[model samples]
Target: MSDIISVGFIEAESDATKCFRQLQYQNCPRPGAEVEIIQLAFIILGLEWNVVDVEKEYGIPPDMGTQINSTHWTGMMGLLSEEKITMVLAIYKIFLDITPERMKSVLFAFPSRYFQTIYVVRKPNETVSQNFIMNAFPSTVWIILAATFMIIWLIHILHAIIFCPKDSSIKKVFYQESGKSLMQLISANLRQTSELNSTGSLFVLNFLYLLAMIVILTYYQTAMFSNLVAPSYYKIPFRNRNELSARLLEGKVFMTDIKRRRPYCAYQCGDLYKALEKNPMKVRNTDAEVFRDISNNGVFQSKLDVNFIPSQFNWFSKRYDKIIIKDNLEVTHYTAFAFAKSQRKLRKKFDQALLKLLPAVEQITTAHGYRTRRRPFNPIQERHFFALSIREHFFQVFLIYIIGISLAFIIFLVEIFVYSKTFKNIATFLRLKT
Candidate 1:
């Protein structure tokens, strides 16, 4: 029998190796049958394959070399565990945990791909235009204006209370009573004036404050109540692992590290460390498990309602259609194949074959979904809507117009009902007299 290499793969599909399979696969004879490229790479190096799928491990205790354990082995800790697999061909394992014992046992290879932080946020139902702080500046500015108006309103109220007479009655006109004083002060705040008995500083302060309040309030109301239509752009709620961790802390999202729990940052990123510290429960999830196909139509797993991925994923992004992959790159690391340290000769042979084949092998065209995808970039399936222009503030304003018309019609009916009742009462009274 040919030397069969049992390669570990994170099944349920969300692992980084899904893209690795995309790199290896070519012809599929039927649906749901996958032919991986790593499998081909091993075959190219003259090795038979035993693809071992990593099973889900929820509510299980930590194994040796785990983050929870006393050993320094982090991430998956053991790719060659159970002695079933001769090598680990995909996934980046940082050399931080590679101790002298590990160095003697297993050989780590060079990284093939660059990885960065890409956030998978819940696909929002509305446009993201004016959603971020750029869009929220209006509210902040309005709050400032309201603060300024409040100061002015307070000044006017004081002028009405202290400078103005408390009693309006002729008998008590000279005496300052608290009741009428408070009433006048409150009334000035609403009517935009202060009826002070004096004319110098008190009048000036009251006039300036009341005038400023009225102007600002009028402007604020105009902005708030106008037929103004704002455009919305699409945005995911969370960005980085820390933000997702915040959501997890707040119970806005959930994380499942059921398959492989020991993800002590492959690159030991400080931000990821902080995020993990903030939310220990926001465990990492494999991409395949998180995103799975359910229908003939390429709909992702409906149960994937994660408000955030809640953890960092060491992956690349060349195309971003739905989940926004920002330009900010994190945890720079290389990817390479791994083998037992004893198999130096075999590893060298594998490397030699990779040198000749990778450039050509990687040039595979994008045709079928999931087969040719890489990292964060995947071809988005196209859907059609019959000529509805969504580029600007079109539908948003139209919705406002519809709502306004509906309110107007309702008021008109109410007015008609009241007028008809008045007329009916008058006619009945006249008829009774006659």
Candidate 2:
């Protein structure tokens, strides 16, 4: 037994020498010297008595002195370089001694330890967490949707202002008639010439321009309101129009009235419209006033002459008996993206990061009480602005066409007059020469 145990130090020393060579150390210690140092360290550590006792108890082999001496060098060297050796030993100790439960606890407690080390090695440039990068920043899909809509609206406005006939006529009218010095014949007739014909066309052009501007502005405002403003104001968590409409009809939640009178707990604006349709009440106030009345009255009550529905009610009623809360409503799903700054490389990185994290975010959100069936990324639904409606678009286009044709006619008339004046001047010059 003594002979067998005495050879352990020699094996340890051999392994150390092998490691040193593999690491390409400039000045490797001799195995015998390392073993001597290890033995001294073990003695200091109070293991000398245990080693001697173990040797005596194990067996008898007087020739084991040579093996023991050789092995001593390996153990001594390991003890001398205990700092690095201890770490490696500790890993093995943990693997052997640590229970599965305790290992789990350690891992949970120090999750960031491993993550940060790996992050440093793999992604030195990334300081932000994946969670923040994927969730906190705007998504690329959303940004694209927003930008696309903005560009389309901007082009529409530009087309109306620059190439639209209504705008062109206004410019022509101002250039030809407003700043010109008029002859007595023209000046006398100008006031009598029923300026309504020309002035009306100009007025129509101006109206179209104003209308176009209003439409563009209203569309932008509505988009912003649905996307950002309404969310902040209503605090409704519905993802799409259907959900929103259902929430409204549910009649439990109140739509926010920032300024108007507060409605009843059970009623909404939709209910009031229904009540009014069933029996038109002359509430001496304007539409705004009607809203005020409903806000003050918490419940809709049928009076002999007037029926009142609370402004807070969300139910829809087409007729007295035909009241149905709409379950389906139209909603738009817009895609957008976000980034920390305008970094070209980071944009791609961000996109890849988002793709990886999207599933995780969705899982987390679902766990946190978000409705899994509802699409949370859809844009909020609201009433479309009148100007942005299809009818308004067509009307504006027709008005522009009429204005363009009228302006062309006026320009032709001006050209004819200028030519006649030039011809007269030339004739007078020829007569004088003759």
Q: Pick the candidate with the highest TM-score.
A: 1
TM-score for predicted model 1 compared with the true structure: 0.42
lDDT (tens digit, per residue) of candidate 1 on 163-206: 44555553343233334444454555466354766478856765
Tell me the TM-score of each prediction against the true structure: 0.42, 0.16
- lDDT, candidate 2, 262-315, per-residue tens: 322222446444443443433333445434443432112211100111222222
Every candidate's lDDT: 0.45, 0.31
Model 2, position 394, has a per-residue lDDT of 47
- The reply for model 2, stretches above 4 Å from the true place, is 1-311, 316-392, 423-434
Specify the highest-lDDT model's number.
1
Error of 1 at 358 (Å): 4.9
